[model samples]
Target: MNVMSVRRAEASRRAGGDRHERTVWPFAALVAAAGLVMLGYALLAQPGWLTGLTLTVCGTNPTAPHAVLLAGVLLMLAWGMARGRQTAWALALCLLAWSAAAELEAALAPSPAAPWRLAPLGFAIIGLWHGRSRFRVPLNATRLKQAAEISAFSVTAILVVGGGGLFMERSHFETPVSAPDIGRTVVSMAAANPGPAAFDGPAWQINGIALLSGGLVIVVTGWLLASAPAPRPAGRAQRAIVRAMVSHPDSETLAPFAMRYDKSYVFSADGRAAVSYRVLAGMAVAGGDPVGARESWPGAVEEYCTLVERSGWRPAVLGAGPDARLLWEERGMRSIGIGDEVIVDTGAFTLHGRSMRNVRQAVHRTERAGLVTEVIPERQLDPGLAGQLRRIHREWLGAAGREHGFAMNLDAMARGVHPDALVAVAMAPEGYAVAFQRYFPAAHAGRNAALSLDVMPRTPLSPNGVNERLIVDMIDYARSHGYPRISLNFAAFRPLLARARSSPESLTGAERATIRAIGLLDPLIQVDSLYRFNDKFQPGWNPRAVYIGSWFDLPRFAVAAFGLEFALPYDRRRTGRAVTAGDPGFEPLKGPAPVEAHRAVRH
Candidate 1:
């Protein structure tokens, strides 16, 4: 490779192979290496890095306690540098200068190579100063205070409990030890260096305390350095902006989903477009694509990435359509196809042909079972009726379930939550609302009304096919009135799953293994069951993909995506299969479905 190309390659690697991340020295890795160096000195009982210096400068492995504490601070600063935080830059300047001064004090004047020995460190200090403009993101005072308070509380508690305990039980030491000695030993243990403590025998209690203190320190670093600042909620002004942007007909089917209260929005420079996103596991995950003025999309995308970078977060998109996938690629992101959105043309759809037999039978069967359907704007619904639907929604999700929606589902069905959204209700023979499907209007002109399915839930006792029946009613209504453009449930890995279901023999063993693995999870995730339902609709499919800041993002992406979709690592600790709120849904790249996700046959 040529020199420039080689430099670029190395820079990319140093940047953790992600351009979206603000390139700072990888601080966590550096902290780890520093810990390793400390380990070397602790084990050898000599200062390895400082061994070249005169021995009079060193007293008993200075790397143990002091260096360990300094390493944590350095790690935090590295995080700041990655975030372009000004405070981190100022602190780093001081830290580097101190290290350089220490080196000078230790160096012998006669050694000519001493200058060379310090060149790399000198260059680093100079480079850091030269890059001052890169550090602009100031630490949020409130967040920093919280981190400091928590770390201080943890450390103080450990010292009081561990150090006091050790001092009280001085007999545990091999030799008689003073209170100050016990205090220093406890400090060393909190710094993850317990070996310096001279124990009389197998001191399990001290060791346990050391492990706890070390673990607390690790948590301290993560909380202070890597945790995202508390997410800013959309105020009246921003929510007004989002509502204004999403209400327009051409904002696309998924546009209204941007109004989900959980997400924070990023507006273009011109203030004409916005994208809604949430930060999870150090990633800013934009829900689908940006919405609003077409000309301003690039600005919105740039603004989103910039926001994420300023906070030291990796940028990602969860349900980007084909056009959006390309737009993200232009920003140097990599993407993989996650699923396809099923869009059915109302005028073309009919319960005819043998291929439509299953859905047709379902619709008829539900109708014969005394299911009745009604379509109306949520605005027209009675307050009592809305309460019933909400109840059913909760029951469908079960007791411990959360709505788990982002891209295509809203948390609740409150009025003005979704502008121009329609609700389709299916009632049982007994007269209660058995199930309901809320549809967000993509755009409505004259005879052309485009709708995308949003929230859907039904009671456990509801008969089979009430969902199919309700959907058919909406399709028939739209077809009779205007050019019906209806969107259905998103089918993830549809092609693969369909192939697995229809022709398993054609797949390689590895592919078969993957299919079988999903099948094993099918009882929990319900991937195959939903794919089967969408297939019968004979809808035209629009391919969709998920984008990540970089390949290194894949690991966290999986974890965050899981936590976001199923509340996996999140609170409530509810265990049952659960999908996010909607389908006939393309909260594309959605994870596990709630148990009975398909038993309810919701779309």
Candidate 2:
């Protein structure tokens, strides 16, 4: 007896496991069944078996089969709900209920019609209502109530259109029919005329128009609901905060954590000891409130100075105010030569005396090296040669450990431009390319034509003189094209061989102070070297000054704010020597000023 009981228990356990597996996805079987039913009906309709069977079972009542199908769908939805599939169940139940309602309306009516015509409209309504909860979640109670009211209006539109059409046709419209068998004809005709009977009365016409308009309104509303935008993903912090706020609206203080890390600063009304930096432009705050400020070139400079004073930190202002040198002198600051801005005329211009000699030497050497130089429109330039230019650029970048430089992408360049610019290259007689330069036309009126030079690596080249030849060739090309000026744009400074010499040494107290401030912030030795290299170009120099609201309120802050990264560093060696050299009062001299004049020298 005991052995028999154990065997029965084991069998029962296996049966229970099978039942659990079956319940895992109850909707799967329903979906398959529905698909099969639809396929069978479509296929058998050719032989008239499906339609004939449906009529035989329902006695020519079109709604009977629809009601049975809708009931089956509802049962499937209930099964899904009982199996703990919430999302699936919600969608299925809504669809099932809508389908059932539509089927019942069709089935119980005095006349019934084909089911396919009602299917699309029923499914569209089901989709609109399925995910309504998610949309209403973010909205307030009032908005939710308003949405509900709109939903009612939409339903009213559908019902008035569907029901009114039937009423008007039956009560006021006449049907033009010719048939043989009275009973059979009545059934067929009535089924076909499920909508309102043909209307002749004026009131029926008006009601018909109203129903048509209402149907349009419902269709439009359904389309809008179906086409609504998808919900956006929420960050953890935002999601948490939203949840907390919704749960506890009265909480005054929330967690201090934020999704992003951004530095911010505040300052007093007076711009003293505020904040400043070279790379980063400090955010402006006034009286513990964020300040609204514009971000233009001039506005940026103004804000930079203001923040410096407010921050109460000290640093150098390489090239500062006109009166800055005087302040530097008073504060015992220092300064040095940085670089020069080179400019060349594309129109009629001549190199005289020493300038002419330099140009002649570069041209003579380039020609003697068995090389040819010419300017060709970028499009006419050989594709292979352009590729060589890009390769050279890559080599230079690799040597410099720099990822980005003036390298052109071949595929991009191949897609040419109108009135394309020129590229000048010096090719050796042996077919090896020696040097190349790219010239661009002026972008706008009043802007000078420009070009960038990149000479081959370590090819017995003198950067200064070779660069001069490249510039001359560019200028000649521009002139031939009728451009007015060709700007060199950038160049390294060489103080020892400066084309235009600046005044030996002369600076005021304020200028010395500002220079010292800049030096303190950026103490890198390489900066001065770069300055000297730029000076060689003999370009006109202009002092790019740093302006502040007030120096007294936040002197140190201003220094730190506009320190090293944003502002250039002052060379103490240069500024000190200049200051000590017999303070010569400001004297306006004529003739082309020295390149150092543009070097941001202390006043």
Candidate 3:
């Protein structure tokens, strides 16, 4: 579909009317204001002094209670109507009918205020009817579940209140209340104002009726929620669409991760572009920028944000590139630079320079340890060899007790290995592979110049240089294959961390505080160590960021990000099994590591 048509469809879906339709919102607002005014008048108006003196000086208006209730109901309906809720429109109509009856009652009592009270209610009803189409968004599985859950909660509250009321009423009686009497009172045909014995029976019976009714409601609601169909997944057609877009030359380092099975897709109205995100802790976090035409990205972001908000989830974009950042900011989102990404220029990279001495030394040490390296096309790897790699990965995860994902990580590395992808492995002297790293092919700015590091795993007992060896081999392989750039791991807080570590004595307050904060994260993440490891390659650092709309959501976004990344240690089984750190099914990509320099240099 064309962009214009898509937007129109979206508008129609949201408003259930022509996008250009004039809303009846003014009348709704007027109705709410009128109700508030009536309430205020009833609460603040005083009777004439002589009448007040004759009336016992209670200082209360007889109309206040009714006015307050009417105002509250009106305001709630107006609020919901403004948000285009069909339920609010239905309730408003019901309330207006009830108010009309009240108006007739007042007129029969010979009150002059009846017509005035009915006017705004009549207008409200008209406005609600006219704008009924505004509530166009249909209730999906998520919404159905939400409605059922709300019904169940209402039933619970009603039961609690009714039980309490019954207890209070029964307490007035000197005799103890019996369960049988309570049941009898609930379904009782007895008249009101009965004796104490009769009251006790009615109270318990009323309580019993409440419990039965509420209990039935709860059960029905629960069953509906349970039986609701599971939400639709991104099927083959959607994947094909994304896959086609993934080749469009502007995809970033995080692009590959967007295709992971756990994520859902939101497309631009044109269907030419899409954003991928997973819901974690009620946050709809996009893995990165939209995956199609640059022109359609804004539309994709807008659609993603709108859908997420309507679903009652906080929308955010994480690990977005500089281009993605601009689009997110244009949408009025606040962004924070989360970290730096290291990209190595393969064509210009060489190990002969003095700066390459550390990496070269690590390579030599690994060679001396009889470590051999090989680069294999992922699709051609043997199943037994893949199994061996999985064992190594799980062992590493067991000790690390953590696996991180979402944006830079791929799951089930061996299961969904892409045909064009490559895996670099380092074989220990013992003749078995000790470490391996997976690299994904990606395009940037319409050129196949980029290869991204996706997964890295090394046995804890493997030689220190094993990881270095795999990286070195991967870089050489990329360079030989004519790829101009290879993306390394992300280094969180790299700039401030590098400054703090290189010259601690000259630290500013910000840097000092940054170091302290990083120190606190040392147990959870090797922030400094990872920075140092990636530094060895002397790659250019590109800043990475996360964009959000509110400070209150900062913590929520953090928790959601961590959860999606699998940073938390959780045991999948409930047995007395020993706890392990990473996913038993898959391990996410590892972050960049700093290379150790061959010679020490002055800061």
| lDDT tens digits by residue: candidate 1, 1-603 | 897567555655654545434455554244345445544454556555555431222212464444444445555656556556666677667866776776776575565324443565677678777767666565656657877998789878888898777877788787888888888888776655666547764567566676677566556655555545637656656877877776554466677778665678999999988999877777788888788876888899989977776676778898898656656776677788887887888988888999999888998888678777877666556778878987887777766557666676766563424435578888777878878898876545433247778867887767888788888888876665453688777778887887887897899888888788878998877787888888888888887788997798899888777766665545232233322335234132211221111112223
RMSD to true structure for each model, in Å: 8.3, 28.5, 9.6
TM-score-better candidate, 1 vs 2: 1
Q: What is candidate 3's lDDT per residue for 1-603, written digit by digit as tens?
A: 998567545644553443235354664586566456545654666334433321211122334433444455556556555544455556667866776767657667855443555665567567667767765322346556676777667655554555455565776546677756543443331221123355534545544443455344334433322212223446656766776666567666667666665567999999878999876665678887788777888788889877864554666888888877756665556789889988998877887999989998888788777777878766556777777887877776676544457788765565532444567877765768788888876663335457888878887767877777777777777766666788889999887888776788888887798799888888768888888899998899988999875566799898878777764543121111221224364332221232221211111
On a 0 to 100 scale, what is the lDDT of residue 84 in model 3? 45
By TM-score, the candidates rank as 1, 3, 2
**Candidate 1 lowest-lDDT run of ten:** 590-599
Query: Which one wins on TM-score?
Result: 1
* Candidate 3: stretches off by over 4 Å: 1-142, 145-198, 201-232, 399-403, 444-448, 502-511, 567-603
Spell out the clash pairs found in candidate 1. Answer: 488-584, 489-584, 489-585, 577-594, 577-595, 578-593, 578-594, 579-593, 579-594, 583-603
lDDT of 2 by residue, 156-215 (tens): 654555345445345444664332222232333223232443345555444444344434
TM-scores for the candidates: 0.77, 0.31, 0.69
lDDT of 1 at 598: 14
lDDT of each: 0.69, 0.37, 0.64
Report the C-alpha displacement of residue 373, candidate 3, in angstroms. Answer: 1.1
For model 3 the TM-score comes to: 0.69
Highest lDDT against the true fold, candidate: 1
